[model samples]
Target: MPFRRKLLEQTQRDIKRLKNKGHKPTTLLGIFLYGGTLGFLFVVPIVGGAYLGLWLDELIAGYSEHWTLNLILLGIAVGGYNVFRFLRDKT
Candidate 1:
């Protein structure tokens, strides 16, 4: 009886937590959309940084990839931050 009561209390607490957070059941389409959004958020900055760095390197007239690498790293940092912010906001 004590075990059953504890289990029921735990379940009730979980349900309350979900309800308080406005948790929604995920669907296939929703899954796809969320994944796509995450991908876009993560990739766009990298691609943009690559292009901009390439352009700058070309303008510099040198055989170095310093700018491209630096920008790509920066892009990755930005993308990570974006994903972190998105997840934090969702939760």
Candidate 2:
């Protein structure tokens, strides 16, 4: 029937429009994955390094002022290194 043929034609046109629009579901998923990966790569190590230094300082020096200052310096160093690497990385 003509109605069936028109429905098929409309469906084909919709598929072409969708393809041309470049709005696939995978595009959003890829964006999210890339964002999450970059966040994890950049953030997790800095936080983990600070926490590790804090734990080590507490275990070794108890409640001393030197321990507190040294741990803070260690965290600063780690943060500085992270910033430096980020600035240096081109890829």
Candidate 3:
């Protein structure tokens, strides 16, 4: 059909135009901000875990640091996983 042919021609032209265009990040500030955000995302959980773990350990009123240590390790693992997932999706 003539209509189909015209539609196909238009799509072809659009594709060619798109092929000439480049999408990239060219801003230093943007790069730093994104990096900071990624770092923040990765650090918050660890700090939060540390705080919570410390509180939990204090509740038992003892000289043991099992909860604090375990939670801190858990936090590190969670932060690493979060950063990994974020980078995977973003980049």
> Which 10-residue span in candidate 1 carries the lowest summed lDDT?
18-27
Each prediction's TM-score versus the true structure: 0.73, 0.42, 0.75
What is the per-residue lDDT of model 3 for residues 1-91, given as tens digits with 9 covering 90 to 100? 9999999999999998788655654699988998998999889989999899899998896687888899989999999999999999976
Q: Which residue pairs overlap in candidate 1's backbone?
A: none
Clashing pairs in 3: none
Measured with C-alpha atoms, the lDDT of residue 35 in candidate 2 is 62
**Candidate closer to the true structure by lDDT (higher is better), 1 or 2:** 1
**Best by the TM-score measure:** 3
Backbone clash pairs for candidate 2 read: none
Rank by TM-score, highest first. Answer: 3, 1, 2
**Least accurate 10 contiguous residues by lDDT in model 2:** 61-70
lDDT of 2 by residue, 1-91 (tens): 9999999999999999988867655678877976665566556656666576667677874564554556566656666676566556834
- Mark the regions of model 3 whose C-alpha exceeds 4 Å error after superposition: 1-25
User: Model 2 — TM-score against the truth?
Assistant: 0.42
